[model samples]
Target: MLPNIEIIVGTYEEFLLGYQLKQQSEEDGDQVVLKQTFADKSHAGSLKCVAVQGPWIASGGSDDRIFVYDMRTRKQSQILLSHSGTINSLVFSPDLTHLLSGSADGHMIATRVGSWKTEGDWQKAHAGAAVTHVSCHPSSKLALSLGGDQVLHTWNLVKGRVAYKTNLKSKSTLGSAPDCLCWSPDGEHFTLSGPLVVEIWEIKKAGVARREKTPAKPICVAWLNGRVCLAGLENGSIVWISLDAPEDEAAKNISAHEVRIKAMSYFDGTLVTASSAGELKIWSCDIEKQELEHLTSTNIGCRPTCMALLDLSSFKSECPQTSKVVAPKHTNQEKSNVVAAPKPRGVVTIEFEQDENPTIEDDDNSTTSDDTDSAKKSKTNHKKLKQDEESVGQSDDDDCEKSDDSIADFSDSESFGTDGFSNDSDSNQRPAQRKRRNPTPVGAKKAKPKQAKKE
Candidate 1:
């Protein structure tokens, strides 16, 4: 199922490309796509982010503009311009009716699909800082924005107001402002990462559900499942944490790249990660085992800034069928006789009639003499056990009562031990009495006695 996907990669060199992979044979691995689509200088910028849905792909970068392209036409259809600063992030709504963009100018604008008009007033999302990343909730009705001012803002698209805002600075230490944000598939929780900590939060709560210290600087983060999160570190490692475990325990770390990880995405059961060293790796995620199996790696010869997975199921309806490759025609073919199974006889019928009333039968009411005798013996044994337990309990209670009644008489009659002192009174005071007795110094003379004075 994953092999049918098409990958679109945006690069720091201002290049936007598409790739289609296929398996030529069972023994060999997948064949990488050599043909790619390139953009001209009219749409040039260091592509910072990209988003794909159905047959549409949107990219933004240093140009302060977004280029929306159609895969079926292989051309750019529209260019949106509303940002005063560089576009840092781009995301399409879950239903693909609106495109949301975050810019370094602290503004978030949503535009409709075909109209190319702004839907509502552009939000001044972060007052004094750039919006680093933004993600749409699964309902497509809310958007989450992470900003450099150390705040997370959740916007209500329908009402055109800020639904909730959370400050992500750590209370104990001050350097853990969030740099990236990812919403879970179920939309009940989200994750934030920066500096040394990764925190998971419930959508409705004001406090974090769990916070964990990472081994390296987490640059990007993604959710692998409901309970597990994958963090891409600056040192080319991916740390996997199980939120169900204690916060202080060690997380499983996998060495993924030789340099800082630039981007990562998980679709269906496959994971794709890229590094600054120009290496792209595909991994198969085992959800049940909580493990990653390395599938293949490709040297793209260029650093990738962002990546997106495109499902081409909708493209089949728009494109011509001849665009697909076909096997060569065989010249000399031999024909062979084939047999076909016979058809079944026409509509065999059966009939059934219902009875008004049915008689019931039960055999458990009768028992043999031996069974009755054994049952009686079992009842007697149970009764005996109950009596023995109750008698033992009553005897223990009586012994405790007797001890309580004799306490005063026992204390009045002073009893001495082998040391010739009452055990009850002296036992509590021996340690204090030992400290009061003075012992002379090892090498000092004894003190002289004092004489009485006359009036």
Candidate 2:
């Protein structure tokens, strides 16, 4: 099973876009929290996009400017004026040294992290409509961008050149723009969500290898444990898919919210999904075994526009003499990664074999203590095995009807809700007063940090 989860909510008064941060956390699973609000100036347009580096939070608004804030000091550090249209998305390099900003003007700019100054660094990244989303490759020197032209473009970041470009044929049917793109952890596939359906594309040689559709219109996609793909659906449900399993493995759906799912992120084994209703639901997954368990669900009171995970180890190492003592070794392992059962190859086929009924027992009792432990483990495994059998049985029936449907079958009819802010907080309103609440420094929080609670 995946690890447990702790949730932090960024209760924003307005629709937020591009609000993501990279920081060190103090709490175990809930290390990162929305400690403060900076630059409430609504005039910068609708704070449409945000990106986080170690200590800096970079955000863009309708004002066609990029603003960088220092989280530690709780102050606006820098602002850059460049885009002619509203900024929609911002992405930071894996190393957090470079920033990429996408705007409605059909252009993208790459700037140094600390200083938003762009001299010879800016590149005309896209040609059609607006650049909707930008993603940096996990292990390669490449990056990908989705454009309003219904095309996916790949870039060679080091050479600053286009490597490949492919139009999303499924998107053409919707006659709308692509809004978001998510790359799988292994960089072998990616998902595009917008205007009804979530399309999964396998990275092929200069083209798409294969594509699959889901039931709900997807707004965000995240890789939970390098195996399963978690899709935040517009219908307030979170769908979990085991990529290793066949296309019809009965997508696991959890009713996570009452409104549209706006953003999602996964760390260790915990899945954090935010909705337009201002609720954040955390789900746990067993990636290898293709099982999902609902964990704690908390209402953050205000809509969460964006979310990100911050590793606590990075914070503790920064200070050694804090009064807050770190947890024991067991706690460290629990916080390090998502726990998933080892995936059984071809779950559908395995179910058939087990259902046929064949049982055998060994006649050895000399190793009594070890044998008892083995028996308990076997019992837990058997329960999970039975569940998979049922899932496969149900999926077989569902697949028959869906086979004739086109690739667009996954799209759903759902409209984006009105912006979460009140009528008084329209686009014309100037940015409002900023409220700052600095979190306790890394070493001054709780003691014997709680273990990430498993589902």
Best TM-score goes to which candidate? 1
- Which residue window of length 10 is worst by lDDT in model 1? 430-439
Q: What TM-score would you give candidate 2 relative to the actual structure?
A: 0.58
Candidate 2 lDDT over residue span 243-357, tens digit each: 6767655666877777788888778776677788866565566776656566555455666666655433232222234487787565666767757789875422111125433
In angstroms, the error of model 2 at 342 is: 77
User: Candidate 1 on 232-350: residue-level lDDT in tens?
Assistant: 89999988877687767777788888899988887778788889887878888886676898866777777788888787765753545567788865444422333457998664333
Lowest summed lDDT across 10 adjacent residues in model 2 is found at 407-416
Candidate 2: where is the Cα deviation over 4 Å?
1-44, 72-74, 119-124, 169-175, 194-196, 289-295, 315-455
What lDDT score is found at residue 215 in candidate 1? 77
In lDDT terms, which candidate is top? 1
